[model samples]
Target: METMLITGANRGLGLEWVRQLDAAGWRVHATYRDPAKAEGLFAIAKKSHGRVVPHQLDVTDFTAIDRLSVTLKDEAIDVLNNNAGILPARKKFGQTDYDEWARIMRNNLFSYMKMAEAFVEQIARSRRKMILCMTSGLSSLSAAGSRGTASKFGDGKHVYRTTKCAVNMLAINLAGYLAERGVIALSVTPGWANTEMGRADLDPGYSPDDLVDPVKSVEGMRRIIATATIEDSGRLMRWDGSTLPF
Candidate 1:
């Protein structure tokens, strides 16, 4: 069975990935910040019959990441999904909270780099060498300016957008750095989904009815991940297998 490790697997898109992959017979290492608060994931793992295992992990915690690396040293991780992130309330240019901005950057950008750094070797040794970072279409510079149309969603959300843009760059850089090592690094956008973070209140102008289903979104992404080749690496791709602008 293929082995995959997914961060932020307690809820939302990450949880769905764990469920779908486990059902597909992949051995899943699902990590969450607090397993005690992840009853839903725990139930899914129980039903998985040992295929899904949950680990307590805060992606922003480097010490915890180091400990995890040591624990899984003997195992090869075929895919490492950097899925944990925080989306703070939108702040206008003059109203920006520097402290919150820093926190978001640590969670959304720096943690991804740390995860890749800690697990690149393990991924290299696996059968399907892939490091997938979950990004957002809101990260697109082009999309930022074209918000008058119905297709466009987020307008401001400066912190979230900037961090996701950084994530795209990180994916591209890792792809180049790990190319010779036979690893494919990709920044994947899960699209606007009906999750906690995608609620109408959080992402104004888009209701749950306007959002894609989490299950369907994750299913598409899993298909994309399964079939992605080295040539497809370093691209910012959507759940539908189409390219998104960085």
Candidate 2:
């Protein structure tokens, strides 16, 4: 069976990916931070009949990551889906929170690199050797300016955008290193999906109605992953398999 290890499977697009992949008969090692925040994930696991296994993971915790790596040491992780991230509050040019900015960078950017460093051997041993980073269109120099309406989103989220951009670069850099091991490491933007983080109050954006379906976006991403080859690595791609600029 094709297997995947996806972090941040508690809610939003992360939760959606868990549901879709579990339905498609893929074995999923789904991780979430808080059990209290994971009711939906636990419910899905209950119905998954052993196909979906849930692990408690805080990607920002390197010690926790190492422990999980030891726990799953013998298991083959085909895809390491780095999907855990935090949504930033609106911050104007002068209002950037340096502390919070650093926190987001650790959560969104460094954790991905740490996960790869820990689980790369498992990925190398898998049948479909791949590592997928969940990036954003905001990471792109050419694409960010055109993504969402400025009126709704305003000029904020500098930290979130910066982390995504850095993670994209990290994924590309890993591709170069892992290529010798036959691993395809690529980053993909899940688009502006109608998830909790993608809605108003999070960043004062549109309602769920204005965003793309999370399920549909994940479905497209699955297709992209299933067909991805080494040639596709080191590129920033959309859920629809289109390229995004760095």
Candidate 3:
């Protein structure tokens, strides 16, 4: 059976992906920070008959990541989905919060790199051999260049955007390093899924129907993942299988 390791599987896109992949007969290692809070995931695990196992993990915890890596060392992981990340309140230009920036960078960027490094061995041994970092279209430098404010300075969410932008570059760098091992490394946007963060990304004028359904979003991303190759690596991809600029 295909094996998957996905972080932040307690809710939103991560949970949705876990649901879909588990139902499709995948042997999934779904990681979440808190077990008590992951009632949904726990319930899925209960009914999945050992296919959907939820593991405790905090993406920012390097030791925990290494521990989990060792635990799953014997298993060949087909897909390692770096889906855990944080999005906090932003500060204005001159009032930027350095601590907040550091915290988010740890979660969104450093943790992604750490996860890939920890699990690359198992991934290299798998059939699919993909490292998927869940990112956002809001991080697109190209979109920022073309749209947003009248100043053309880009949209806000300062700390979140910078970390995501940096993570996109990190994926490209990983692609080059892992290509020799037949690994495919890339970042992807889930489109405007109807999650808290997804809704937050939209403008105030948008409505409930404006957001992409999480099921459709994950399904499309899964299809893209199934077909991704080394040639498709190093590029940021939309859920619809199209590439986006850094």
Once model 2 is optimally superposed onto the true structure by TM-score, how far is the C-alpha of residue 213 displaced, in angstroms? 0.3
The lDDT for every candidate, in the order shown, is: 0.87, 0.88, 0.88
| Worst lDDT 10-window in candidate 1 | 145-154
Worst 10 residues of 3 by lDDT: 145-154
True lDDT of residue 72, candidate 3: 92
* Cα lDDT of model 2 by residue, 47-98, tens digit: 9999899999999999999999999899888899999988788788888899
Model 2 lDDT vs. the true structure?
0.88
Candidate 1: which stretches are off by over 4 Å? 145-154, 200-205
**Model 3 agreement with the true structure over 117-211: per-residue lDDT tens digits:** 99999999999999999887767886862223521333457788888889899999999999999999989988868987776655656776878
Off by over 4 Å in 2: 148-154, 201-205
Give each model's clash number: 0, 0, 0
Q: What is the lDDT of residue 69 in candidate 1?
A: 87
TM-score of decoy 1: 0.94
Task: Report clash pairs, candidate 3.
Answer: none
